[model samples]
Target chain A: MNGTLEISGLSKSYREPVLDHLDLTIDDGVFALLGPNGAGKTTLVSILTTLVLPDSGYARIGGVDVVTSPREARRLFAATGQETTLDDLLTGRENLVMLGRLLGLGRGATRRADALLEQFDLAPAGRRTVATYSGGMRRRLDLAASLLTQPAVLFLDEPTTGLDPVSRNRVWDDIRALAETGTTVFLTTQTLDEAEALADRIAVLRAGRLVADGTAEELIAAVGGQRLVLLDSERNEVRSIDTDGTAASLAHAMSSLHAHEQGLHVALRSPSLDDAFIALTQTHQEVAA
Target chain B: MTALAPDRPSSAHGVGPWRSSGVFIGRSLRHSLRDGEGMLMAVALPVILLLLFTYVFGGAIIADGYVDFVVPGVILTCAGYGAASVAVSVNRDITLGAMRRFRTLPIVSATVLAGHVVASVLRNLVATMIVILVALAIGFRPSATVLEWFGALGLVAMWILAITALFACIGLVSGSVEAANGYGFILLFLPYLSSAFVPIETMPAWLQPIATHQPMGPLVEAIRALLTGAGEAPALVSLAWSCGIIALSMVLITLALPRSKDR
Candidate 1:
């Protein structure tokens, strides 16, 4: 529970409901809160990060209530915001060391700053001011600053919203590497691909509430099972079949295609989360109606 | 890959409250020094005005000892100019991601504003001295005792602290850095219209009352008295105004700071 988050009946509203009595729990691992533009993804992160207070409900980070004791909860985590929260005028090393000093690290602050700069492969660029840094460098430096004081939980608010594919992959690798070390990462994303690519557990939020919560495969199954398209040597579709997406069912479906043609190729396509999101969102609306 | 590891906060083993304040103050000081243009303008504006008024406009005015009289006023204006940037810096911290990140940490976020104010005050004091030295070289002389000179310096410092805090409040409430800078410009113009350049009596009758009532007027009059060894210092009156501005700005900042962090 040291890196876990629990929320129950958490609600917040500005002009209207942004996050309605939403309840959620995240265990130790990479968890993604996937939602479109206004699904209260930020509101949730803001509340958890103590940027804003929720109207009603409680949220606990690693079992410490964020509302009642934000300072204690602060000690348990670090966050990287969407807007690149860095002092552009300061050198990367200065920024990191300043954060270390602010966090009360004393001389260790400088030592950690140097070590982090080298580790991020930014030792060469650490002497440069952030204003001169490229977008990728800025993000990497921002991440380095956040990790100055390692927290049990790490919150990344849309960690890669506007990065090129290569930079995005680098950040992804860094994130995945962090999760491998047993730090619970809670990230929010508008793109389902990012969620699926990074999160072990994905929760889709719609209009201030959660519509579905499960693994990628479970949400994929919710919309429809996997599709099997048998192709000939020319790569033209020879036969199409639907299966329940289970190991046995996929085996059966593949075997059925095996008897049809000797030179056929079999291609299996997993269900997309885009379809799963639409299906789940429509299901919630239908039930409400 | 484990670069950020074993990196947990050493809060328990490190600095006390005073050292924490030192780091924030040091950051703002660095920013003040790096902003070369602002610092230059703060020193240059007063020096430029002193020369212009002492030579350019001095022949037209019949007032005796104009340089001596105008130097104190110019120093007061110089402090105002130096304090102006505090608002812009404060606004940047609030509207940008810097203060947002700070709030998430274990430190009190209000210290950012305090750092700005203290750093601005120190920067302005230095600018004030440069202006004074420039005035002295250009035939400006005063007849104050050593203690009175100290009194004038202390009063000027208090006035700088007050104005700096006021600008900081402007920055806190401003929606953008440009807006804060604009407000600073408005503050810069206020000292010019006061008894800074010419005596309030020389102004049109209607404008005289407005100039006399402004915050800069009392401090200028008091400082002039202290330096010239002339009549009443009106030190109590200027102190009251400076204290009032400091108190009001502090109240507004205390009230505005928490809400500044909100959406």
Candidate 2:
């Protein structure tokens, strides 16, 4: 199928293997690449951004080969990395202007800078040097700088890892807005909540290869079964139930218990994205073992 | 919070590569201007050296003439100092992630380095002018023609480029700003030990050969040759050394740049 991002047999290793023969496809909208630490999410982002070279395989953004014509491929993408990349020597506005100029904005760079500052709520501190900016402000400024180019595809590599909930939500809103404008966003995050909130399609990666790829609902269905269970406790209390296995049997058991009016608390287990994630990963580990 | 709206199209004017690079260079220049203490050091260090050598040590050391002798030394000192300042700036940018941001842009990497080099050249020229004015005020005069003055200035600019390239490479390889500063100070001091500050012959016999062949030694000799019309071959020697060092450093830096695999 035609995709906004197409990767095949991609491999990269630094000393030890980071991304092993991995393949995946992402179309428009926010696609979240989720993995735990050292899963090569950042490595993949770096390669896709033309900042690092992969040892093997190829990636195409909007059908432009990233390795072959990096400059042209870069035109299709912008990235905000985990570390803040704002120039501390310049003011927030000046940093944006520099980015705009580098992106070929010319005299219009200043206008764009001002607009970005306003959009990112940096207008109040636009004149202040970035050295004085707080962590959240710097991150916001960094994100604003990346958007100055307005690439067809944007990469946010763990954009909200260290942010407070409010700041994270702010970034999430900005990301959602970008997607609403039909900008393809490829974000990598260790936070499952972030993935659930922003990603229309989620791909779970382990040791560089995609272990699972689907919408949250699709993944949940694939894992199978919704179970409702109860455990006996003292004083006619109900305890936890394991929701792994057949849904019909669990529901029937729950219904029977309810019919009896036994003093019980009910716990229902439908396969969630988290459960799918755990099952897929554990199965892979068991096979490897 | 305001909505995260994409910018509206306000103009159709797009910048070409040359204009964009110019803006980058101009912005860097403006940053240096705003740093008053930095500007002072760039102008003051060479002037201080010139005065100290010409007044305090001029009597003890014999040369063709005191002002002419000290002028070349001071000029080389200024150029060396200018290179160190560029190193500090570059190191700061690397540390602050400015270089990382620049690398992501569509602009060529060479342009960013070139912009910094141009700024260093310009700053060196200003520093040279300040030193000359101070020397003139203290009764130092060059009997050479305007063409010779221009030639001397060209040599100084070339020396600054060479030195700055070497130090910029150091900044690239440095692990931290503190390490860059320490190494830059060492590099700056190397020129002082050469003919730039004291006569090479005044040193121990074993050290004379090393001092005489140093990059700054020939630069000082060349500047002195042009300033007093002394006709020394030191300028030619300086030119060769400067070009070699610059070429070597640029190659190493380019190699280091691509090999940086930090995600």
Pairs with backbone N, CA or C atoms under 3 Å apart (clashes), candidate 2 = none
What's the TM-score of every candidate structure? Answer: 0.90, 0.86
- TM-score winner: 1
| lDDT for position B79 in model 2 | 72
- Tens-digit lDDT track of model 2 for B110-182: 4666667778778778888888899899878887789878878888888888888888788777878888777
Error of 1 at A172 (Å): 1.1
* DockQ of every predicted complex: 0.34, 0.30
- How far off is residue A41 in model 1, in Å? 0.4
* Candidate 1 lDDT, A170-202, residue by residue in tens: 889888887876678999998888999998999
Model 1: per-residue lDDT, tens digit, B1-263? 24336654522222445776788788888887777888888888778888888888876774567898788888888888788888899999878789888888877667777778889989988998898888879887889999999999988998988888988989888889999998877766887787777778889999888888788887888899899875678788888898999999989888778532348
lDDT score, residue B8, model 1?
47
Model 2 misplaced regions, further than 4 Å: A1-3, A220-241, A245-266, A269-283, B1-17, B54-68, B92-96, B137-145, B229-233, B259-263
